[model samples]
Target: MNEKFTGIVLFIRPHREKDSLVKIFTREFGTKMFFVRGLQSPNHPLKKHLIPLTEHRYWGTINQQGLSFLKEGQTHNLFRSIQSDPFKQAHAAYLSQLVDASIDDNSEDQQLFDIFEAALCSLNEREDARPIQLLLQLKLLRRFGLRLNMNSCVVCGSSQKIEDFSMTHLGVLCHNHLDTDPNRMRLSYKQIKILQLFNEIKLNQLGHVSISDQSYKRIDELIFMIYHEQVGIKLKGESYLNQLYKVADQLKVSKIEGT
Candidate 1:
């Protein structure tokens, strides 16, 4: 018997001649691979709802392992803004792919589900959604059993006067302990504050994040370095995001020089 389930489509790929395979993060069963029949056909009913990064309710067979079968599906949120914009599409791809890679198959995590859902909504609603993306990445770090100590110095465990960040220690360092690691990176107070703000941000109630592009670039660099050294998972969208942002930065420089 088929039952109704809620899921956010992570991706869809052509399986054979006419069929396709879709990976969805279901609230009930975590991440699932559903075998979608005749999905390549133009008249398929569920094709619209099965788009990557959209949320939907579907009638499907729930299996403990292996591919499940989808009978029908309905759109919950198409994320039309993300669908229409190239930049938002890039962000969605990277965000969804990151979450998919971090979680194991069939693992039940309601918190992750809510975070991902809120992230999509935030991206759809806001023009500058990079802050929300950073927030998601920071929180998702714990899902991999990794946490960056933003509160205090990683060496002395002091919560006073944090002045620098250490890639080697994977946390902030106090003024007193800045020299504890020879590889500590000098960080401006603004960059340090932004990192703290990222951890404190509530995704469900997010507002216009006011961040200067300079600060955002620095913080993005720190997070990317940490993910590179620790997470070590090369996602398909990562390279695209890097290239896209690099081009965006160059454009901004050109504009500034022109003015």
Candidate 2:
């Protein structure tokens, strides 16, 4: 049967000498792999659209037992800035990897697709993209039905005087419930507020919110810990992103010292 759908390319792998296996997360079909013959050729028509994070409309033949065959497609948004900028590219790659790891094959999830698209767009356009990336990770976790409760203590349901985040409990712990887990990470009130805001606010409005360096570190660590403990997927793109951030930080320090 032939299927037509709109999707964002999540990954591409070389199938053979000339053919490529393309994995895309589609609005109509959750995640599907297509075998594009001669995609490695310099002149392949669909080559450009096969890039990671590129949104495209695709028409392809579905194989009952194995890989699908791509017939044709047109790119919707190439996100040129994301492809050109190293920071954006790393973040975009990480997002793509996260989506690829989280979703199941051929399972249609329009909400997840929308979130992924919005994340790429935000990263491409926003000057400070880390908050946007962090927000998207939280949304992705929620979409997977693993959302952490920031409103109150998961153990005692107390909202007042929340002081720490318990990875074991997967929520905020009030001062009274702090002893429930000796290993719970202490959190400042401001950090708790930032986590709550991320949960409540929409992705596009993330630009308006300012995150301090400390808050960003706390949130980043929390999100990564949740993914590690709950999701159980190790993403290579994340390591690359960390390296990029380290380099960027070093450059910033050097520039400051030189002035």
Candidate 3:
């Protein structure tokens, strides 16, 4: 049965020599593996559409149980901007890996799909990828079953006078509740606001995504702490991005010293 569906290529892998398997997260059907014959052949027609981080409208055989197959497909979005830029490419890869890990096979989640699609579009359109990256990461925490308490103190549920972030409480902490967790992370006034903003960010209607360098660094520290202590998922995309940042920083320092 041939059916058309829109999907994003999460990753691709080699199958028995010359063949390949693509894991695609579809709007209609959560995630499925598509087997392609002669994918590595010299003149494969579907080669361009099958690249990672690209979305396509595919007419493939739908399988409820095992491996499905792709007949043909068309480009849904080339994501040309992301394709051309390394940082954006890294963000796309990281988001794709996060989305892939957070969902189950063949499970339809319209909310997850919609936000993820929006994030991809936002990433492709925006000059700064960090904002979108942070938004998506904060949004996906609920899906990962590690929702942080942003509204009030996690210990006493007090909404007033929220002073710091408690890693032990896995949420915010009020001034009164600070001693409850001795390891609470002290957040500046701006850092607290940005965390709330990120947690409540709307992907499709994003506007003027801006944060100061200092606050942005602090926000990442908080988000990363949650992932490290609670979520605990390590991704190759993240590892690559870290290395890329290191190289970029080194280059900047070298340029400064040479001047």
Candidate 4:
């Protein structure tokens, strides 16, 4: 009684003794857990083969409790670009944790799986990972039913060019729309345009657009506010990027004020 499927390792944990419990997001069966007997043993196939984020074609079973054992696993590329760079590695780990936290077991969503696969591959191959990260977050939120309106102001439903925008209420609260939330983020037209572009453009096409340093800061704040409201958890990766920008901002201000 066994089932065979292809999956990507999302997370792995050591089990009792030499065993390990591996969590994988599979294309056929969605997220699942498998207990690999003697996974740590030198002779075990998983000992040298299995790793986080590695794609594997596995033969296992869905028992009463959960999936168990590993008959065979063929490992594909380990994404050396992600593994080699510290920043990329950290971002990949963060993305993996987010996906692992959000995706549920025994549910198959091929679209979501494809999006995640595309995102990981893009991050590994892309020269700049920021746009890919942004796109992934947006797509993930949308898949979870938290859709933000990029085409128009959610309050006024105006398709007109938005001059001033806010993210507290999860959309472009236009100039006339009163900000009920005190923490509503006010963004420039350029910031809104970049966000709109990010929503529309493909990862490879993002290189065509140019965003200013000031605009990126505003977009970062808007994304943080929007994602926090939707997910109810502040992303440390966003905070880390914000801190770096904050330091640069302080330096810039110091030079301007000669303090």
Model with the higher lDDT, candidate 1 or 2:
1
Q: How good is model 2 by TM-score?
A: 0.92
Would you give me the overall lDDT of model 3?
A: 0.86
lDDT of each: 0.86, 0.84, 0.86, 0.71
lDDT for each residue of candidate 2 in 1-259, tens digit (9 for 90 to 100): 8888898998889978998999888888788888889999999999887898789998888664577888889889999889888888888888888887778887788888898888888888887778878777887786567978989889889889888898888889998888999998787889888888888788867656677877787778788888888988668988898788778789999999999
Error of 4 at 89 (Å): 1.8
| Model 1 weakest 10-residue run by lDDT | 200-209
Residues 125-243 of candidate 4: C-alpha lDDT, one tens digit per residue: 87666677776666677656777777777777887856555555566655556455455566677777777777877655656345677776567666666657667767555556556
Is 2 or 3 the stronger prediction by lDDT?
A: 3
Q: What is the lDDT of residue 135 in candidate 4?
A: 67
Local lDDT at 213 for model 4: 71
